[model samples]
Target: MHIIKYLRSLQIRPNFVKKISLIQARHLQTDVFETTKVKYKYPPVYDPYGPRPPPSEKVTQLADQIMALTAEERAQIGSALREVLKHPKLEKISTEGLDLSGPAAGDAAQAEEKKEEKTAFDVKLEKFDAAAKIKVIKEVRALTNLGLKEAKDLVEKAPAILKQGVTKEEAAVIIEKIKAAGGTAAME
Candidate 1:
């Protein structure tokens, strides 16, 4: 049984009544306590990506005027628009019909494939012989158009990149020059 029931059954006297009332008050507070979920509210906002409203009367009239144009006139307008918007993505917009589907997903895939084919190379300098350090410095200076001190510092830092974004033929020629100068180099 509850402690309050037990206390009441004991019938202790007026002296314990105050302590009994305090305990009952605490018990009553715990019993009356309830859990409730709190919901948060925010001000209304306009979402641009949501469904668009209908066109105005002026826009409808413009559309009707454009649609009433001759095929030749429409072709001329289409060519003029294509000239104005000279982008590969915009090329897919058809002037023959109202093609609202926009560019296909394959365009991004094709661009990724083209990017994967490496066309540029970086020339990296490996370690060089101590005796031919001057010649290596001169070679680096000639290749990078750097000052004498800058070139020497670069040569000191072995396994460093000398030049970037060079074509395959140019990279081969650079490697040959470095080899002749007694310094090892490779294309990255």
Candidate 2:
């Protein structure tokens, strides 16, 4: 090959020339043999349980005592504990002119709004009188977009949820209709 003659003229040793020719051949071929190294940024893991000591016996004993209390008593204790756990420095710091409602407060307000908005309700038909079964079926059929056979089957399956994710007003209207039909219904 012309490459060998060129390498010989340059006085590159035979073995080095062979290596050079092989590398050239590799470059001439498809780029399948070439690879690129990539550096990646991996996020640090948060392991709260790692490198933590076990709770002391006294703490465990107190936990057991708290567990033994009634649910209402435990709730009261929990509220008291939360109050106790509040940073004491917060009480010492006087904010007479500073605005308390900052971005963090806005986030808290949004969370409260999310909790207050109960937009969805599930309407459940608890029971129906044998005499009012037909009326209940009709009411259910009207409330739901189900056919007569499906509505009848739904009515027969007492204590079943008629509809889910309905608005509060719609659920109330459905409940009222079912009640008027002599079927006990509730919204959950």
Error of 1 at 176 (Å): 0.4
Model 1 misses residue 3 by how many Å? 97
lDDT score for candidate 2 against the true structure? 0.87
lDDT tens per residue, model 1, 3-68: 666767788675586677776787879656777879977448867688689999999998999999
Local accuracy of candidate 2 as per-residue lDDT tens digits, 26-127: 888877677899998755986766668899999999989988999899878755866889734334678896657655855887766656568899999999
Give the runs in model 2 whose Cα sits over 4 Å from its true position.
1-114
Residue 165 miss distance in model 1 (angstroms):
0.5
lDDT of 2 at 164: 96
TM-score winner: 1
